[model samples]
Target: MKEFTFTITDPQGIHARPAGLLVKEAKKYAATLTILKGTKKGDLKKIFTVMGLGVKQGETVTVQAQGADEDAAAAAMEAFLKENF
Candidate 1:
């Protein structure tokens, strides 16, 4: 398993557009990906769950990836967050 925390930098937080894009990217990996906001957790491959977290700007969230290709998933997700949020 791989995990890390990343703070939201986008002024609008995740919203729908970015969340959809994230889900699209996440679907490429076989590993399971999840994001946590406080006590709320959501699957990265599901846009609705991600948006349901209600993550806001400046809030830090933990991302976890497990199973086959977890390392690659983690690396890609980290890069995506850095580049997008």
Candidate 2:
């Protein structure tokens, strides 16, 4: 498993649009992606699951990618967060 933590920088947090983009990005990989906030975890490929996370600005979001493409997926996810979050 490959994992990294990122603090949300978007003023609105992980709202609908970004959640949708995240889901889209996650779908491009076969890895199983999960985002953990405290004790809660949500599938990164699911819109509702991700949106329901209620991630807030400055909150640490831990992303874990597991599967064949985990390394690439994790890197892509990190870049995605940095570029858009």
Residue lDDT tens for model 1, 1-85: 9999999999999999989999999999999999999999989999889999998999999999999999999999999999999
Q: Once model 1 is optimally superposed onto the true structure by TM-score, how far is the C-alpha of residue 82 displaced, in angstroms? A: 0.4
**Candidate 1 local distance difference test against the native:** 0.95
What is the total number of backbone clashes in candidate 2? 0
> What TM-score fits each model?
0.98, 0.97
TM-score of 1: 0.98
Q: Following a full C-alpha superposition, what root-mean-square deviation does model 1 have from the true structure?
A: 0.5
